[model samples]
Target: MLNSAYLCGMQKYKVHGALTAVGMIYGVNYSIAKEVMPHYIQPFGFTLLRVGAATFLFWCYHFIHGGESIDIKKNLPRLLLCAVLGVSANQLFFLAGLNLTSPINAALIMTVTPVLVLLSSALLLKERVTAKKALGIGLGLSGAVLLVLQQGESTAQGGMLGDILIFLNASSYGLYLVLVRPLMQRYKAATIVKWIFLFGFFMVLPFGWEEFSSTSWQTIPPLIWLAIIYVVVFTTFVAYMLNAWTLRYVNSSVVGIYIYLQPIFASFTAVLLQQDQLTPQKLLFSLLIFSGVYLVSRK
Candidate 1:
């Protein structure tokens, strides 16, 4: 009984720990990935690199750990859909949007994900949404709108477009969380992600190939190379794996509420790197975002 209890406690710690780590990695990723886009590599090119490299890594890991074959016929269509929403659309929109917007703005905009997830769950998974969750959704939406309004007109077109794309990315991701949950029960996280990346590679290929080919690799500096490596390895490979594993232990909305922590880490990193500022308005908006996610996540 003691051993079983100890294992259960440890398992809980690991699951939550993995989720926290994913948030931190992704928070830092916003700044790191922003530094590489539209200069050293275009968004599409960078996304291709991210998805392609991650696919290779996932496959390599799967091979090393005693190769397991999935029920291809049964799971292929769902896996392909997962690839489109989770890998292709998610990465492509995020990188493209991050390129056009400030890392802080991008991070703040992502705070709507939990709200989106809750709504998606309610609609698709037949999950319940309490009055508190509805209030939370309203709060999150207000925060996103306020953040957009906070931006000056100097870069309105680009910033607005970027914000919209980020919202789309969040929507795709939110729905993905709901859609992928069923598969989580039937397969290992690695198994699901490996196939997702494989299909994602093809889905993104047509869109990203030209930009990827146009990149002048030899002119790139070491720091940019390091950033690129971080995006592919940590942001793409490790983060997805952690999220997939966490889903096996919790609801998709529970997994998504962790996005509330992202802007804190993102702003801190951006400030440290002199990439963005920490203003009072941003703080107030972030509070609303935090409050909303907190309400939505309450049991």
Candidate 2:
């Protein structure tokens, strides 16, 4: 009854849909996650929860569906670098920044990555940078500065501090993407993920331990517990696994496009939920940011 071509098309559609869902989850997570932090948990402490639980889950999944072995000596150093850049430092800064800033700022600032990637490609990979892309990169950076300057209505302790840290986090993450690009060709996604999180757990221990140890879990609300669970299970694990799976059916550009959708999803979700309001400034700066990203991301 089913045509083979139709079946193939459906499978590809579903895979792309899965990647879009990953972006949506990431977008919505900004508001959902900020609610629990510095109230039910500190940023570093929550990072511990995210990395530790996800690490456990990765290992469990690996055991169930065993994969090829990695060369520890050859791979460990690079994987360790990924852990530090991708998993440990990136999460710590993002959550810490999100805690201090509004979800809208956090979400909008993240969309600047395409420009980051283009620049990184040019500098590191020695790829050609056209004038259009150079202008795109300039627009993205200008938008980021504009984004960080807008004051949120209800801020945590250090809004400026959060903005700075988020840029640092974005930089580190951009470099991680570049650094790991080669290894991705050499290893399975799961294999790389397992080692990255495994090493990342240790890298975060010192920064996260005291806050995690001091957390008064008993005083937290059931909703806070649910938020934490969602961070680990849905935001980290499900989003990432779906992204990896999508690679089988789609190229990196498709995956990257889905990431651009996160801020839209986040901004709309926050506005609809009354957690954040749109301003003339926000609208203008956001357009600048996404416009830049569109130019850089376009083929």
Candidate 3:
């Protein structure tokens, strides 16, 4: 028989490894999304492809793993909301925003989602937000503003409409995160994802059909297809699973802190692959945001 002490130690190690893998997966997701955005598909088309492909892959995995199927009759309301918030609206707004704004600008706006979540949780869920939490959120917001200011020239060139769309995306995503947790606790992540995708696919179908009919499918290259697959499988499917798994093990506060890393990873990847320059301002703002998140999480 295995010793209790050895089993506990093994479990602890597994949790840590999972958290690390989650972070890395999230980082790669941002990098891959940024890389693939401009190559083969327009943002709206890309979003549709991503949701469709991921929906298929996730369900296939679910069936293969013998996961329980979602009961539509029992969970219709929750499923509908998840589909609207998490899948259709989130993807649609984010892609539309990207078309209007620079990726860096979009990433900077997304950094505020944790703060939004904290506030929403307090208002809607009655979760306690201590003074320290408020301070941390404030600091994080300041850092985000700095990061955006650092990219002022690009933002100005991108125009105001895109910036507004990006902000909407950020707000919608924050609401989705806060609201989805309870449902996640009650349902299997895979089941939640499958239904969300099904709903999202239908939601986007009318619009997607128009775009689909207009495109010449044969002219697209193999590399473009590969990029779409990467975005669909890794970014959407695997990333969501890792995120759901990590949330089960870690506090939401900790998860909020880790999300700040997305922009930093995106910025670095942009510099390395796309030859985008990183200004001193971005570095400073990033530090400020990290410091804020650290402060908020500290007991």
Candidate 4:
């Protein structure tokens, strides 16, 4: 029994690691999008294409895997709310923000999401925000502020529109996570994903037509097409599936903590891809955020 319990614990850790890796891949995909998509597609239009592809792939996966087919009558309200919060609002805010802000600034601003999730969970779910968690939130927020300061003149010159949009993006996603936690618990991940994407597809259809008409399908480079495919497959489908699966075994607050790592991963990827400079201040802030998240999520 002791060894069995130990093995179970190890298995859980492995599963969580896999989920984290999936999240990292999603982050990388977003970084790639930041680099490539803007050259060819408008942000909203790009979102429409990626999400549309993701929706189709997820639907086929559900149908083929013998997963529960979406029952609109039973799940309509939940699906609608998810589509609004998770798909429509979240993506719209993010794409709009990315247009207004530098990718680094956007990434830094988004580190606030875990804190927002904690606060929302505390207010809505009565989840206790212990002293350690509070400290963690403070430390993380401080690190984010430090990062903003470190960016200095460039960030200041970039204006606040992007920053505000990114902030909204973070908040919308946090709320979506909190809102979806229960539904995820009640249904298979694929079922929830299927409905969310289906509703999302419809939500964006009217706005996406111009994009569908204007895009030069034959002229798009193969490498860019490959990036789009990667975003659809690994980032949209697999990443969300892993996130939903992990939520079943963890609390929303705990799962929310993983978001703190996104900026670190994003910065690393930026350095590798863009030859961006890394400074001591950036390293320190990253450490502060990671330490804060550890305190907040520690059992």
Winning model by TM-score:
4
| lDDT sort, best first | 1, 4, 2, 3
Per-residue lDDT of model 2, residues 184-218, tens digit only: 65667777787888899998888999999999989
Q: Rank the candidates by TM-score, best first.
A: 4, 1, 3, 2
86-107, model 1: which lDDT tens digit per residue?
9899988998898888776777
TM-score, cand. 1: 0.86
Q: List the residue pairs that clash in candidate 1.
A: none
The best candidate by lDDT is 1
- Once model 4 is optimally superposed onto the true structure by TM-score, how far is the C-alpha of residue 20 displaced, in angstroms? 2.7
For 1-299, candidate 3 gives per-residue lDDT tens digits of 11112324566456445544554555555556655554456677777777888889888978898777556788788678867877888887877677666666776677777777777777876667778777777777787666655644465666478778877876776776667666666667776777778888889776666655566667777776776677777768987776555444444454555556666666677678865679887888788777876665455
In the predicted model 4, the residue pairs found to clash are none
State the lDDT of candidate 4 residue by residue for 4-97, as single tens digits: 1233557667655865676477557557776545577767787788779889998898879978645679878978888887887777778767
What shift in Å separates residue 240 of candidate 1 from its native position after superposition?
Answer: 0.1
The candidate with the higher lDDT, 1 or 4, is: 1
The per-model lDDT (C-alpha) reads: 0.81, 0.72, 0.68, 0.74
Residue 16 displacement in candidate 4 (angstroms): 3.4
Q: What residue runs in model 2 are displaced by over 4 Å at the alpha carbon?
A: 1-16, 127-158, 244-258, 275-299
